[model samples]
Target: MGLALFELPAVSYEGNLKEITDQLVILVLDDGRTFNFKRSTNTKFFKNSKALKAAELKPGDRVALVAKLDDRAFLVASTVTFVEMTAERSAEIAAGVRRAQETADAASPVRGWDGPQLKRRALDEPGPIPDPRAGQSPSDDPLIAKAQDAALSFSEALPNFLCEERMQRFSRDSRMIGWKPLDTISAEVIYEDGRESYRNLKINDRPTNKKMEELSGSWSTGEFNTTLRNLFHPASAAVFQSAEYSRLLDLPARVYDFEVRQENSHWNIQVDFQKITPGYKGSVWIEPASGRVLRMEMQAVDLPPEFPMDQVETAVDYAFLPIGAAAVLLPVHAENLGCQRGTDYCNRNVIDFRNYRKYVSDSTVKFDP
Candidate 1:
């Protein structure tokens, strides 16, 4: 079922364990609202400071957990701690949740975008919460201008080049822990005149005549410039606001939150001959002073429950690489994750761009017959 966006502070949510499954745990708050949280191997479970397994969690148990909502609108638990369910303590927890809700509600009006804002907390450090820059337009924000200029120059600053794309496909059951390899796809990608085309498709080193996009699995294109256009192009009408300070590639970055309304979004999702353009929201990590984008994260939102897929999230990491005697900023690594609706399964694609070289039209090779 599609869920409404819920805003909460970066604090532990105290609740009673409502249900437990192999993949997730449901918690019922004092106000009777329930939350479904995805559990992972990294999710710490404890009772009275003693480590415990998820299976040990029982319904009606008083629990407090640190969780953040993901792009899918599902809460992902980082730490689940079971507490003693005393009459006085239960009342205290309920009051705490109420206060959190109030704080979130007051801040909601200033939150320009709908997405996760809390950076994962470290064991010894507190997490960074989003500091939304209220009452600012794209034209009035200096950070937004920097990003727009960089994005506008993205294609113009590049030279014609060729690269090898290596895609590793993986899948895992939602109830399971790790991803299993599905297949490896390789193709030659040509970027000329700000456009990209693929040729020489291969699967596991075996060449195929079929087009790269014709393959029978999750795939994506337009990582080169389309993403920048979608974010910075005037036609997109994307909204942006300051999110938080973060690090990318060990470099300090200023993260900005953004969203592209469905009506203006060019992002297309296809499922078994059906295609739909859904509204998307994500964060852009830009170099603080230069405004150069270091990374981008995007996720589809407000999907119909009847849609075959319920989740779509992607992350693209960029780096400067030498191509044609000049270094150019380009996508180095990307990850796309999609979850099927009504099923406990998801697919992930890890894409790498390598072997970059200048494209020379007159280049020729000779071989002995």
Candidate 2:
């Protein structure tokens, strides 16, 4: 029912409050999952069905919190419902929470690439929105057109590649609690066939939280999903349009943001048999000098009423690096944020990509005469 790629289960987290800060709260659920919600002005708090302030919720209270990632990449409480810890039953549930180091697989890098897949719509056709880039340069510039053409065209066959990733998780909102280090882990991501897989490697010699691992993985992919190729691939069924110019890695980049609002769009998420039409919106930056995507950002909006989570936002950056003999633009970093639509909570992540290499085959076949 949850996003398998991000490792987020569709189920809610119910347990006793473990930690509460002015900016965030942590709940250790009956299962090993830890719920982190970022506090915001819009967050609603409830104590025994009576509305109250977030500061009123105490640690150890029996609580049920819905969660999503906030703008700061922190998962703060959105709406909290709790009953004061009456007896020591909270201790009972606390015992079930596993705080041991969670080692995600070190082999596969991505859970699997789901989208950034576009609708293959005809953006060049006349439409309600005039090409925003029309005034940037004369029709002869062809900066935007060529960039669009580059994104639309897949000329090279992409062989499998391997890269090292450093993922760090933080629990505190810098805007409030300053900085709180949560966990850090490293992994190897491999792109084989068409799907991306992740293999957890080193845990930085630090204990890893099972829940954080899932959150981090989800965050990593969510951010990378917005890259030009991933979103505008030939198989996509999404829409895009020219927008204002945007800066990417300090260079002037043309923008072609996109959105998906219809239920029929493949960008909509589904749980079990139900489709959660949480449409996606984001901007793509292309530097026409070489006609390559330099940056991308995506956010999920207009979620269905039944959706358990609220917000989803991701940002990714691409840099040209010498891969084999060519300087290819590839993902170098990404950030993902999610919130529970039930107005419960939020979570965030920052990922670093490095050490990329083309996959090499070691197998050889001998033919008999």
Candidate 3:
């Protein structure tokens, strides 16, 4: 007689009960066997309390358990401890994690390297001023080191970044229409007086066009750092922290409590963030290695009567740019809805931008002009 499916172990298993939604639970055994079992069968065999708690699973927790096979899924079987550690033990583990993070933050050279604090000296002032990378080679500057480290870390975290993209809005939908591609188009900001205020933007470069337009109207180039700060802040604050994508995509750093899952070499991350008062839930998907955000979904919960909308959803697919940085192209696909007259006013908007880049554009005013 052939061995029944339940006789085998699950192919692979990770995540807590809440994370797994199907009726059948899957578990991978130590012997490299795969099986699926019905949740009903396992419910009687295993104590309800024996199930692993999501909070108990840390970054590096491994467990081996027997599994029974159901129709097309594997469920956890008996004879194994559900959690490797208790809540108290997990808390201690978390404390260690916190300390490590703190130590790392303290050691970062940028902590004390305030650009505004650096004093400008005369040409003949001193012997050799301290090179930030003094003890090290050209590769030793902390900034370079940090960038390298960030790149590596970002490579690992890229899979979880979720980007909400919307298509560009055009008059025609069924038929195709072509506008000036971002790369081929050059833009010059012209003032009301018909004089060119700013005319130096190359289509290939990544610079803030909105800011450029504003400055063109009133010849002022603001601080570079401040512009980056403003552009990134809204997205950082909107997304959920505990969402899986947040943890996987480490950029914008605010959303970092994500969990990663790999399937057939393709990784999936679930990132969620909440907005209180008028409750809202947001989630997204990220391509780990490439840091390409694939999709974003959101919903409003327990909305107040005064609120016009009850739910929202968005998804974005980034093209061409394999990594998140300047000079990369981003075409956005978005959908939105607002409540009006006891009905939802749904609108779809698509924006395509390429060679849409951001950079520091500054000019020294000699006052001779």
What lDDT score belongs to each candidate, Candidate 1 first?
0.75, 0.56, 0.31
Instruction: List the lowest-lDDT window of 10 residues for candidate 2.
Output: 100-109
Point out where model 1 deviates above 4 Å. Answer: 1-138, 362-369
State residue 287's C-alpha deviation in candidate 1, in Å.
1.3
Tens-place lDDT per residue, model 1, 1-369, is 998976664446777897777678777656434566787677889988999988898898889889866666556788999887678976787677677656544542221223222222131123355556645675688878888888988888889888888899988774435788999988878888888988778888888999976788899898888887677888888988776766767667777788999778888776543356778998888886777788888888765444567678888888878986787888999888887764557788999988787877643222111
The TM-score values for the models, in the order shown, are 0.63, 0.51, 0.26
What's the candidate order when arranged by decreasing TM-score? Answer: 1, 2, 3
Alpha carbon lDDT of residue 68, candidate 1? Answer: 69
By lDDT, highest first, what's the ranking? 1, 2, 3
The sequence of per-residue lDDT tens digits that candidate 2 reaches over residues 157-216 is: 345666777776644322334334566666667666545666645565543444323543
lDDT score for candidate 1 against the true structure: 0.75
The collision pairs in model 1 are none
Give the alpha carbon lDDT tens digit for every residue of 246-285 in model 3.
2222232111121111111111111111111222344433
Error of 1 at 93 (Å): 45
Task: Highest lDDT: give the candidate number.
Answer: 1
> Weakest 10 consecutive residues, lDDT, candidate 1?
115-124
